[model samples]
Target: MMLNPAQARARLRKLIRGEERVFLFLDYDGTLVPLAATPGEARPSGPLLDLLARLCTCPGLRVAVVSGRGIADLEKLLPVRGLYLAGVHGLVIRYPDGEEVWREDRAGDAKKRVEELARKLEPLLEGKKGFLLENKSAALALHYRLASPREAVEVVRRICEEARPLLREAGFVLRTGKKVVEFCPARANKGEGVDFLLSGWRGAFPVYLGDDETDEDAFRAVAEKGAGVLVSGRPRETAARYRLAGPGDVALFLAEVLQDRSPDG
Candidate 1:
């Protein structure tokens, strides 16, 4: 069963009260803001920015945005300082102090292979209305959220048929999310990213909030030591122990976290 807002708040407060440090990991697109038809349309609002800034300032709390977007794109979308960013599903991690780390992949030609895949897929999707080919440097995503249902089905079929062999040869993986399919390096995933971040702060209480299939790895990563809050309105099989209705509820819960004034707060 999912915890309601009040229950979630009380539970979190108790956890925060016990921990010496708290680490909050957030997924960008669906968790922090509503999912947009296009990636560019999902820019953060001023209030959300303010809320994040306040959370960063909260004592004994650490904040990071772990996203499928590249670090450069995340930097543009979320300009809040003092916030760590893990992009390309944690292939790249940037610290609040501007230090950055790139996870080494076994495939030395991964970038070249990714570029070639993009080149091959672009033409396939170009004329298909509402199909967007988004190249995020380290990964390529085919967005069909704006396409008609029939068109979406056809596009996904074509992609899987055409791209699967190449992906297998290049050591890449395909991930499906809400109305989109992503071709990314096989070694890069949100779980490794969450584990990487958690490694830096020993004994910290960690809480992650996300709303997609891609986030399942992260949910499992923190399952033993922390809480994974799934943000969705509908019921589904998930590893997450808690759930919030939507981004609006997420903001309210975050506000409660910021307002808590216990000794560790």
Candidate 2:
């Protein structure tokens, strides 16, 4: 069953148990900030960033931003201290310890393909607007959110068709997200990152809150250890056990957990 806002808040509070060994796994774009037509516009508010900055002080509350963006992009979005992050769907992991690891080609290696595909895609569709190319490590995302509703669907289909053969030839996998389609190396996935994090995690509980299909792998991985909450209901084959309406609900629930000191909390 799904949780109402209050219940969800209460439930989250109970999970923390003041243990503080919270290995937080979070999605960046839609989870931290509202989804945008382009990745450039999806910026979190300063206050939210400040809140995260404060949480950095919570002892044992280790946080990691696991997302489909590249390492550089993740760095740009989050400059807070004491946070561990993995980008490009686990392809790149950047730690506060000044270590960076990659599961596939680094951002530099994929630049040529990223540039070439962006150029190729822009010319293919006429009278279509709002297509964006986001280059992650060994991955490329063609976002069509700025396109018209009808045009968006067509853009996705055409781009997928155009990308399929080339991606496979280069040994990549194709995945979809809210108004976006991506091609990435098969080595990078949320499952691998989550499992890897858990291998070193000494937490009694773990939670993953994501709003997209790409998050299903993480959801499945954490099912036995904790819970994964879905933030969308747009017809996905999810392994999530719970769902929420949108990002606002996510903030509200988290804020409540931060404030709660009840017996249930």
Best by TM-score: 1
Per-prediction backbone clash count? 0, 0
**What is every candidate's alpha-carbon RMSD to the true fold?**
1.9, 3.3
User: Candidate 2 on 1-265: residue-level lDDT in tens?
Assistant: 4665456656766777655566668888787778886888888788777666666556556667789998888788888887778888877788877688775654565656666666666667656667777666467888877778887787788888887777766677888888888887787798788777667776646778888888889999889878787776343557976666577777776665445422333
Alpha-carbon error at 76 in model 1, in Å?
0.3
Tens digits of per-residue lDDT for model 1, 13-120: 687767778999999988999999899999888999999988888888899999998889999988898999999888889999999887845434767888899888
Model 1 TM-score on a 0 to 1 scale = 0.94
Residues forming the 10-long window of minimal summed lDDT in candidate 1:
256-265
Give Cα-based local distance difference scores for all models: 0.86, 0.74
Q: What's the true lDDT of residue 133 in model 1?
A: 86
TM-score of each: 0.94, 0.86
Summing lDDT over every window of 10 consecutive residues in candidate 2, give the lowest-scoring window: 256-265
